[model samples]
Target: MAVFWIQPATFLAAYYHYFHGYGELIASHAADPSYEVALPGLCQPLRIRDFPSFLVDTTGGEVGKLVNDAFRELFEFMDEQGHGAKFLVNTFDELEPAALAAMRRYLDVFAIGPLVGSSAEARIHLFDHAGADKKRYMEWLGAQPDMSVVYVSFGSIWTYSKQQMEEIAQGLRQCGRPYLLVVRKDGRQEDVSSCLDDAVLKGQGMVVEWCDQPAVLAHPSVGCFVTHCGWNSTLEAMALGVPVVAAPSMFDQPTNAYLIEQCVAGVRGERNGNGVFAGAELARCVELVMGSGARAVEIREGVEALKGMAREAAVSGGRADRNLRSFVTDTTIH
Candidate 1:
């Protein structure tokens, strides 16, 4: 019953319908990524570059092609199975009505989430290092005033490049905000660490190998989350009422970025042609979502509203709770 789709229900619904065109588009993007395509439920037009990297993968690695073929097989099975394929998505009804509705037309879709936080009050992500002490970062957050720190974390999968890390460090410096940055130790981090030394010495930032993301997002000091826009991170920010500076990298991240920005919950950062978001652009996006400007205020308001919706949907009598109950009952009876 617990599905691990990091992609939102909004795009997953369309994946069931427009999957047929994906191959042609992938080939087209490989040739020239200049065109935009309209999806079924999304109002914003998605350019070829925004599609999952696996689909338009030009790396000659063939990993993208292999992943694409595997998805094609699953799609073929779904086409044969139809409503027999039941998916429990982690999202709320109010959050993505159109996308949910579109999905239900093709299969049995349940909106059972925005599964925001855990029951455990002392939740900590298990990290294998000295920074593993949950109190280490939590203490830092406690020292800062409410809404003073900007939290930056790209998810665990992709290794950040030295240049990419430098750009982000420079951007955080430009923002001149007290920011907490997460850098994984999966290799090639010594150079990145060296780049961040100047900023850490200035007392403007803290760089940890890894941190408990849920706990950090929940902290009062975290004003804005500069994320890669992974689905779980997106939902956590929505539920916790933190505005985002979405720096989507690959997979469903681009679509998630688009969703948050279109909903006015955050700002999807503008990237340069090099596929690298520079330090200056990074600062501009952080300011847009975190500062006191009208758009920033509006983004905060939008985030707060979605926060309530996400909470309500997961509560006892809410839509997601009710849907879960219904699903259990039907499965038990059958």
Candidate 2:
């Protein structure tokens, strides 16, 4: 089975105990271990905010109810046997070492990813966008100076309200840097051209329905990323050595945003009490990441360090490769 993170894996373990009548097994294991296993608390304290909200308090509107119900069933399926199931996560050791180590106590967890195409391989896009001109975007990016552009995308899912889109546009404009803004046509109330007509005409930014995200992030012109803090996006930014400006919306995004902050790879944009993005705050975050102040320099250094680690983890005979091989070997033996 595939689980995204260790927090959910812990919940799966609890559900396994409930279904298999292994009452207090986790507690007993924690108190007095029967087997030599990598247990929880072996790592440093995790930032409490870097966890999904549902795990903390699941009391809200329809979305919360749906998430809670879905998790309930997912955990049950994950632990049909007395023991929790093994899971393959799309993450690497350096990105979430503590959580990965802690979850190994109850579940056989493997970290194998940044699972995108290599430099020589073609990327496999899940969605079909037959008309996008890759050459045109790449040429535009090439024309820009090194580390001069801000790339903004909120992933394929997660439709933003019109207000949110306007605020983002305003933020990009206020930052006074060239940017590539992606606003998919299907889920929005206005067309990209009409919404950012003045900005486009002024050559301040380029707005598109979709572009190659991995390619864009890897581009030399991309200085900072303005993202919704999705896991894939976070990993991509880390892998490409681009700093981040997180504007988290929901689910795992908030947690990912918190991790970005903890790693000093980026800064989280501030939102109002109503959870609305402010243009000023977005601009501030972009400046904080891309500007040449002391904090920005520190963040840039941190991101560069993480980029090296990510590359090392994914290379041949690296930690991720060895871990994956061991998992395969153990499975065959079992």
Candidate 3:
């Protein structure tokens, strides 16, 4: 009798407690041995190499400490588990067949999503729009030519230093492309209008504090996503048939970026360290990607193809949706 675990990715404190102490924190109250617990598997194991480009520097600042400690805890827990537990990951078999296949030896791995499909049923209405403001964004987008606007957002978590942020802004300005920027309320928000020259701001760009992302992507003008490569964002972007410029900053972002740009054709962006892409290099890369209408066309077509596949996987009778239901049944059945 296997019982599934349900933990939110946002609940890092709990993750730290369970993983860092090897269940010693929870074992006192646990009904059975910790080895009997089933865990949620990631698309890949957390690794120093795979840490967000920012976290790779152990000698770096606070964010590094946070990233390092969290992953350290996670791996430590995995090491203590004795390979006796079943693991289920909410990913698709198609997205990472190799990693999933390798994981099968160590755990009863099941890839059961694009979990956004579940978000629709939550009654949260978190992603839905209000009224006029929503329509204004959407209508502005609708007026633009197809694939004209580049959507730029770092996932809710990551923040950029002012210098780094402006460099990106400069790059975008230099690229001479229309963009929608999501300036999350990190401390980094400054007078960016000063940095961008008049020519660059000629009614071409819009910056919003937060947006209903799923709705925005569904808009006709959103051609590509310049993203941090969060798995949820990746899935959502793919679901919208939008190709990506994967500017991943932290966490599993690099892993997701690699999957898109290297493994799949729908993503393009930078890699840092190991003789890959850096910030300036990434700027160049972004320019090259956005400059080419042909490449954009290719990415759009590829995303559309991927979207069709994702739709089938999440639709009522498909393998992914059915597997998710089956897993729930098996775990919940008496």
Candidate 4:
């Protein structure tokens, strides 16, 4: 009955009956209650308003009702179950100490990840990029100056509208920096390259259908990431010491984005009334993160500190390893 989940622990808490004998791994930073607490160094507490329209209820429309109904069912299931479940979160102690501590008050929680493959043999990419020319991309990256290129991708899912894509294109042009933008062939209506001429993209940027994200982020040329703030992407960027420009859209992305911004490791782009972003706003966020000013320096410092912590946690005999071993021992004993 061992289960690995990316959803909130509340959903896991509801289905404890399914995991009576074995353990469950819940991968997230904040629990349901921790979101309510005023984070120590954050500018403001995270609220429902911070979430995208699909996740929160500000306007009373049919779509909003459907979203609310689904959430209501989820919580109702948890409430009826009556007790909380222990969690093995895909986060480390140093990253979210307060949220982890707060969750521990209610459940037996352990922090044991940046949960990525340590060896090349263990790497498992869900998306097939066998056709991609890794050497070519790496060579391009190698030619660029250290900490000079912006890497942009929004994960595998969550398609952006053509308008949104255009805005991002325009924003990148405005930033006037070297970039590698991964636009999924299936996610957009028109070819992104067609919209932006060869002159704007050829020397200044590289647009690929897909590429090895970790490799790109780890490259010395990648100074900042324009990300959707998915937990895996967030952790990877942190581990690599790459500052972020968060353009979170839905799910736990908003929470991750808030945390990144609060920790001074990134800046969040402003979403318009419809949760869409303008090119100007995106440019502003990118400039803020990529600039050599005081705030950017602070962000780089924070990301570097987190990167060290992530490396230490993943090493043998580190805190995460010890915690994982303890979990295994306890499970075997029982």
Candidate 5:
């Protein structure tokens, strides 16, 4: 019947970033022979190495459960299928050939990349509205010099505990740079302001619940981006030619971080043991990236190169374009 299974990028990406914590546990289970009988095809019995990290976590509370469920639901579907279905992950062949290979037996699998690119483009257009929101981001950017401000955001889903938030503030305080932090207003205002309670951050830091991201990144003052390594955010940063401090909270973030830091030389942040980092570490990462003289220059130049490459990739005969075309063709073919 050819049931084509699609892996959600949001789900898979989350798995790539946070899977660090659960690897050992999953690996252990994979070593046990009993796993095959206990969970049947589910593979939880195998070990930590075989499973994504989310399944092994106990710390994120309900949010952790939600993450667990995301992966769970996908596997559950596979288990229910009589012969299973073809699986398609929302990724690029260049990015994750190994995982695609491993899952091939489960079903026919293909990787299509950066699906959120168009979505981000759509969001970018939304900034065209000339209203209070645009004015705030623009005016703020206007006041700063070129490449002077650091734009910091945690993507749409990452939420910090109160203590973590304060630590971030302290780190920003220590960095001694002009910054804008976009944090959701969920009773976390106190934690956000604790570091600035005195005049240490006067006229240096601004906190907004949300801001026009594309506008902010395009601003002359925005020298670097501190981000969660979400594909959309990463692409936007690259498109805007801003170096990224890739602090990936979970999922494909680690993979993304590897690309940015190792391949592109445009990122400067390390994932901690569990794929999560402390606020102090985040601060150090930011300082190294934002305050870096030579590294910053290299990053800016590298970003410019990527922008050129992105343009070529979009052209009719460009590598990216062809890859995209092949992606579509693969998805449609038998």
Candidate 6:
């Protein structure tokens, strides 16, 4: 039986870009994980590491098998359907033209998103189960000076290693700015808490179990976002014009980080010898995005420009709006 899975448009584009919109290339490149490739719109060449795990992982396991199966199934379905199958991707046309163009060569693909905007009202309840201290967090944010707070969250799914959490705690201490960090109530709650010294964070930082992420991103005090580079979070941050300090965890994260850097809107936090983001590296990334310098100014300006485009696309008569309406009309007719 064929299984199905969904992927972000940007990440899906990385697949198309690497395969050159052909399945044959995927079969041919099965041997070389180290080979370099480039997408039309991006400047930096990508290796297998920059793509999704299932695309590169040779480690045979049940998880790998399921993901690989789904990937193959997706391609087969697309190929079988040909131009008759319409793909309504949750990405705005202005955001990823190269990827969209690549897919449209064979499929009826529409770039109708960054769809978390008001028009689409994309919402997820994953964070709700965490019992976030919303009142305290919101009040704290309200009290902070404009553009002074650094908001950090790695989405709801991932739980960091104790060492990584310790490194993050240490980095935020050294970050030299007020930061609001979300430590989920998953198994690693104590791991993060144990690493964080209350003395260091006293009156300077706040670590809550959860917060309304969209609200935090939109807050005026939030200047820099330390994110896992999830697509939805990426869009939210971009739309609000908050500069990102990319600490990608998995899947589409690395690609989104690359996208952020390519757009001159952020810097990726460099990993240490252990392939973990060291405390110093985290501090450096935060400084690059939040510091008062030419580069920081440019990054902020870059994200602001993207913010305008994202809002424009969500509004009536915009590309996202038009494409969405067209899809609805076409589907209704069919």
Best-performing candidate as measured by TM-score: 1
> What is each predicted model's overall lDDT from 0 to 1?
0.78, 0.72, 0.59, 0.70, 0.58, 0.74
Residue-wise C-alpha lDDT for candidate 6, range 75-125, written one tens digit per residue:
677667656678777777777776677666666776776666442125556
TM-score of model 4 relative to the true fold?
A: 0.81
Task: Return the lDDT, model 5, position 52.
Answer: 34
What would the TM-score be for candidate 5 when compared with the true structure? Answer: 0.65
Model 3, which residues run further than 4 Å from truth? 1-57, 60-84, 117-132, 187-193, 196-200, 266-268, 271-283, 287-298, 332-334
What is the lDDT, from 0 to 100, of the residue 237 in candidate 5? 76
Lowest summed-lDDT stretch of 10 residues in model 6? 1-10
lDDT of 4 by residue, 126-236 (tens): 677768887888899999999999898989886768677888888888888998988776767665555555425668998887888888888999999998888888888
Return the TM-score for each candidate structure.
0.90, 0.83, 0.70, 0.81, 0.65, 0.87
What does candidate 5's lDDT look like per residue over 1-334, in tens digits? Answer: 2333244332343243234254444444534423421222222222232223344444456865786676656655655663335444545444344445445544555554334343333554422233236567668778988887878888766776666566667667777778888776553534555544531376887776667677788778998888877767776776667888877655555445655764364664655565455667767766666665777677777888766655554456655456556546665773
Among these predictions, the greatest lDDT belongs to 1
RMSD to truth, every model = 2.6, 6.4, 8.7, 6.5, 7.2, 3.5
In candidate 2, stretches whose alpha carbon ends up further than 4 angstroms from where it belongs are: 1-49, 56-59, 77-84, 118-126, 190-193
Ranking by TM-score: 1, 6, 2, 4, 3, 5
Q: What local lDDT does model 2 show for residue 322?
A: 86
Q: What lDDT does candidate 5 reach at residue 123?
A: 58
lDDT of 4 at 254: 72
Q: How high is the lDDT of residue 136 in model 5?
A: 70
Model 2 has how many clashing residue pairs?
0
lDDT string for model 1 (13-57, tens) is 545544765556545655455567666665556666566656666
Structure candidate 2, residue pairs in collision: none
lDDT of 2 by residue, 28-136 (tens): 3332312223224334322333444443332456876677578668767776643446677667778777666766766788887656564423765655677787788
